[model samples]
Target: MNYQWYPGHMTKAKRMMQEDIKLIDLVIELVDARVPLSSRNPDIDELGKNKARLILLNKADLASDECNALWMAYFKTKGYFTVKVNSRNGSGIKAVEGAIQEACKEKIERDRRRGIKNRPVRAMVVGIPNVGKSTFINTFAGKACAKTGNKPGVTKGKQWIRLNKNTELLDTPGILWPKFEDQTVGLHLAMIGSIRDEILNVDELALELIKFLKEHYQGCLEERYGCSESGDVVSVLGEIAESRAGRLKGNELDYTKAAAILIDDFRIGRLGKITLEFP
Candidate 1:
């Protein structure tokens, strides 16, 4: 499948981050725990060079704990300060401040050498759209400081939110690269709702999801929808439609509704804690 989701605002957002990165002491990047590598915009490595980096595996509560551990180890080996967090409920937010200080310890020490005291660390939160950047900002700030939406492109501008005298956060709009060279990266983004649903064929995406689940997480379909897991993707979707009472005007199974339900259930963790990619 071919997938593309680039908005005009993202172009402007990328330019803005280029300028904002110069003013920050750290870059706190959020990535979906389920597809950590796929959800990240590779351009950030160049954009945030020489900056203290923290990678928060946001929405971690919905991903498999085993995968989360592997991802944390993967990022740590790459020298990034990493943490697992459920940003919506503020489960791991408290550790963020200490991690910030630790990640920027070199910068902090330089400030102390130059006789600088009590200067708050300036940080900017960045991620691909819908990866919970705004939600992480709000939970970290202890207030609804950043506007959030379930869909991509909810935040269109930059705002600096002060968490305390010791730290300040710049909340910028989420961004994606100009193009996805690998179709698998695009597919992962689409599965996790990082891309808009309107531009996608929900049934085809659901089929891809079903195929992945059957291969990687055997028996999930049978456990959730009471359908045999051995059939083709469409037949499994049809089973889901029948189980969920989805029907059309002519009494045909409503595959569209069933597809949407299946995707939603997976997104919100109704199926179970699942991880799409492993390190």
Candidate 2:
């Protein structure tokens, strides 16, 4: 699939982030653990230059534990303070404050030397759409300080939230890049729900997901939907439809409904922990 999605608001969001970055000491970027690289908008590196960086592998519960560790080490090697987080349940959220302090230790010490006491370290949460930016913010701040939604573009403007006396958070709308030069990146984003489902062919996307799972995570389909080990992806999807009772008025198998069910299963981790990308 030739995938590209850059809504008009993203242009304004980027411009706003450029201005907002100046007011923060750190950029707390969140990426989907299943597709870490694909879910990230690399523009943040330039926009947040000279700023302390923290990369939260948000929704880590949906991704393979092995991959999460590897991705954390990968980012650590590149100098980003990394954490695995499941924002929905606040798992690993408490550690974020210490991680932020560690990430900005130099800045904190600089202020100490200059005698600028009690200044809270400022941070802004950023990520591509639907990667759980708002959820992370709300969980980290211990309240519904930011609006939480499953759909993309739920956060339309910026809001600063004070976590404690030592830290403050600026929540910004998720921003996607203008173009996806690598189609694989686009596909990964679509699989993780960062891309809107309305503009996608769910059947084709499901097929791709099936193929990837079959290759990297053998037995996943058979375990979930009793799909046969051998056969084309379409046939496997058909088997899924039959097993899951995806039917229409005439009792015909509804591939579209089956596709939606399977995709939802993957997104919510009902199919078990899965990771779509490697380091």
After TM-score superposition, what is the CA distance of residue 227 in candidate 1 from its true location, in Å?
0.7
Off by over 4 Å in 1: 144-159, 172-178
lDDT per residue as tens, model 2, 1-279:
677787566677777777777778998999999999998886888888799999999999999999999999999999999999999999999889999999999999999999999988988888877988877777777754443222233234555666787887765533546356889998998998878899999999999999998899999889988779699999999999998856898888889988999999999899999999999
Could you give me the TM-score of model 1 versus the true structure? 0.91
Error of 1 at 28 (Å): 0.4
Among these predictions, the greatest TM-score belongs to 1
- Per-prediction TM-score: 0.91, 0.91
Clashing pairs in 2: none
Candidate 2 — which residues are off by over 4 angstroms?
Answer: 144-159, 172-178, 249-251
Query: Model-by-model lDDT, in order?
Result: 0.86, 0.85
Q: Give model 1 RMSD, 1 decimal.
A: 5.0
